[model samples]
Target chain A: MKPITKLTENEKKSALRIFWGQLRKVNRNVPEQDKIKFLKRIPFFELLKKHQLDEVARVVYEREYRDGEYIFEIDQPGAALFIIQSGEISVEIPTPKGEATQLAVISKNAFFGELALLDESPRSASARAIVPTKVLALFRKDLDKLNSTNPDITANIYKSLATIIGNRLKATNELIERKIKAVA
Target chain B: MSGSERSRKTRRIVVYSMTSIFFSILIAGIVYGLQPMILPFIIGAFLAYLFKPLANSFRGPAITKYIRAGALLFFVGSITYWGTTFIKASLPNEREKLQLKVRLQYRLNERYLSLMNLADGGKGNFIYKTLGQEFDELKKRVIDYVKMSDDERKRFLILQKEISDSDHENKKYYEYYLANLKNQKVDIEKLKSLAGSAIVAIEKPAGDDIGNLANIMRALSHWIILPLAFIFILLDKGQIFHFFLRLIPNRYFELAYTVAEKVDDALGKYIRGTMLECLLVGLTLFIGLFISGVELKMAIIIGMVGGLTNAIPFVGTFIACIMGVFYSLIAENVHSFLPFINENNLMIAVLAVVVIAHLLDNAIYQPLVVGSAVNIHPLVVILSVFGGSLMFGFAGMIFAIPTIVIIKVVTETLFAGLKDYRII
Candidate 1:
């Protein structure tokens, strides 16, 4: 019969060695640089460092939508922020006349559904793919998870999101001023 | 519709249906063939899921994957090492007790045989009666053979020697056998045969080896296979998930992915939370018992059991309480180590400790660890625990709540999706 005491010790040593070896290989294989590059292009993720971006990439999901497919419907619960990787997405709002009015055409490298990163609320407008589109989705649950572990990355993401929203609000204000000036 | 469009839709449906049927059969066959490995796979998957967050946390610039993996390996390895050492230390005492019990059982069987011989009026029982004159003739021939050689007689005497000669108290049965032999009607050969059969009956069962084999299997899986599988799963998590996603038809891929995400969210939180809760409860109870002056070893074992049983919802607390009381009483009666403490005092102390531990668990640990992850009603919790215990015993009871939560989340997501499509 084999000596169990000796066998157990040997197994423990071997398992640790194997695990360390595998972990090093896996770490080397992680595509951190690629993810960092992708995150750098988005305004919300631009403030994040390379390592911070890696943390964000861990929880983000990539999805492909066919042409003419609805990304989300109006008044649906907004739970995730979507960043456009390629192709075009059209945002539409229902007007008082009960007809769809185009809000904005979001193209490659832009993002939509920014409000979801802050709160759990319904979408104000619907977003649909104008062409076959690829987007990265960052959900609130994943964000909250990241918040617990890497608070710096999460805080930076929120800060960038706020800046983006502020910029959009200012642009909208400028457009309204222009419209009012024209009417006057 | 146009003719071309109608034909294309029909062809698409046929292809999808056929592919689904073929894949379903293939998956079923694979599952059936891999039945034995299913438990290890599940265990590995669970560990991978549980540690994923920790693994992800290591993605920061300061830490390398080697360091992260090493930390996890060290943590799990230490726990396993400690647990094995504890079991090893306790095993000798447990084995000794088992041997004592077996010896007592053997003695009881010997007494039973002696009683049967007494009931037969010392005529060597039914076997002697069946043999009749042949038995008498054989006994005489054996006596004659023994008388012919001194060495043969000595050997024959040694053969008839009492097996329990070391124990003075149990020598009465042997004396009774000697008295029966003195009676001419009793055949020596038949008595020897009966004694041999009794010895055979008292021999340890061969089933012990099978039990040991099972223990070895469990140990190997828990310590080796599980961790190895977990590492692989964590390393290839995205690939594995994508592989499953690729299996879905393009039309339903998005919906299926959403459903899977919801299920994963619910089940992951519930499972990880419950594990934390169990650990907290167990540690709290252990500390409480230790403070209350209970024996360290017994307290540790009972506390661990109580904590693990906490996974069974409402019933778990009750079981833990019962175990605490029973173990406390046993310690009180046997060890009597607590000076000037009577049974009532010990019982009261145990009850108070258990109650305080339960309160702490409910008020602090439960809210923090489990939160409102599983929002099932208390009534539903009770029914599920009972149903699970009835169906799958302990494992069922432990898993029932999480299983129900997954079902609830998936069905809600599906219904929501249907509502969005206006199909429900």
Candidate 2:
């Protein structure tokens, strides 16, 4: 405090500007290698080889969303698959009673909107950023272009997509069976 | 808003404004520096973009990318060389005769138009009087030909003999006289009134001097810049794409990328398809004209024009037909290598050629290449063409479709993105 008082008027103004500038944070640049490693951890891309993962990482676009911002809404045309890079996303659907129901709270390293990669269709549910989040978006068009250029990688992504979807269907079936038994 | 939040927003706005201004200046400077070659650069870039898929499809090692590009360059360069050589050989010799034909065609068109006006509103009586005077002169000439002196008759015979003896196209001196004599068989009993409706007013060939800046730029772009630009783009290993893509900030990256990809896909197919379709149109026109007994030079010019202006809907057909008519009007007596052709039926034949060319374009070329319409409103299409022509002449009109496609894709995507991203 004493040192600041001793400083000249112009110097004090400069110091304050510097302090405010410091408060204005810039996003840190994540290396492409880190993106590839994170992509490898996703079950949806488990079938892809290291080189294929690298290609995907290179093609994916980084997007930032503020807390409570909707990434996409229900019935909106989905053209891309999104993977969480940081923070949280809430995947939600509307109930019959006209109330909003949270289907899942997706955290870092999780993925959503996987159906869009296979075909362009209206999204089944809405995905919104639960907190300030960064995401890596893999657009279907880019993926398709990449697939077209390399046939081997094309099959891998589809294989993984099918497996994950199949697993989800089985899990839902098991849940339904357990509910029926409990009701009986 | 709270003071800190408001101050932070104010700071962000200032930074953003400054950044935008700085970038804009940089871009402007770069554009200004490349202004001279800008046309060529654009031509080249589009060519490269259109052909990228083709280049990618060719199987080769990475090094062969350069080789393939070089081979393409060579192929294009050779074609240009051949084309220029052909032009150089034909133009100098044909210049006078071509000029004369054009002048005669222009005067004929002008006379017809004025006669038409006078016929329509009973206006321009002065033109009617001039026609009356010309009719008298024509009568005198016909009579003079009929009552030729022995010496004049001998001279005409000698000239006719010489023309018959030689098999040169320039033997038109005799053919003109002979065709005129042959076609003067207009039946007096069946003569109709020369009403305004009787005259078919085709659009005139809007002329400009050859030494214009646009023409020079066009030539430079075609011969030099187009190939260089195309090759550079074709050989790029994603660096060029990444350089531009890197500028997109994190917040807008996904939206920008997706928008760009869509625009690229749309523009690429549209341009390439349209160009190929035009090429086919030109080729068909050339073949049709050549078969229809038109002169080689005339056929080539009209075909080229036909193909180029096909971009502007009916304009190509109009120009091709009118030019074909002009050629037919000035043709030699023994014009057709094919026996079915003659001066009397030449105009019909020319019209038939143009019709066939267009029919081919509609039935085959449009479907096979362009795939389907972009579904722009007809009114919008017309206004865009008009706007483009107003700004940059015929080239603008040709470029209008692709420009509209880009705009449409970008606008639609950005609007959707803003809504879906909840940025608005």
Q: Which is the leading candidate under TM-score?
A: 2
Query: lDDT of candidate 1?
Result: 0.69
Q: Write the per-residue lDDT of candidate 1 for residues B79-116, one digit (tens) a residue.
A: 86898898677553532342333333333333334533
What class would a CAPRI assessor give candidate 2's docking? Answer: incorrect
Largest DockQ belongs to which candidate?
A: 2
Q: Which ten residues in a row have the lowest lDDT in candidate 1 chain A?
A: A24-33
Residue B354 C-alpha lDDT in model 1: 79
Which predicted model would earn the best lDDT?
2
Q: Tens-digit lDDT track for model 1 on A1-184?
A: 9765555888888987788657544764445556557778887877787656766776666778877788877876677788898889999998889988898999988888989777867789989899999888777766886788778988988888878789889999999999999999
**Tens-digit per-residue lDDT, B91-191, candidate 2:** 63332443343334333433444544643455556655667567546644643443333333234434345444465554554444333333344332322
Backbone atom clashes (below 3 Å) for every candidate: 0, 0
Question: TM-score of each candidate?
Answer: 0.67, 0.69
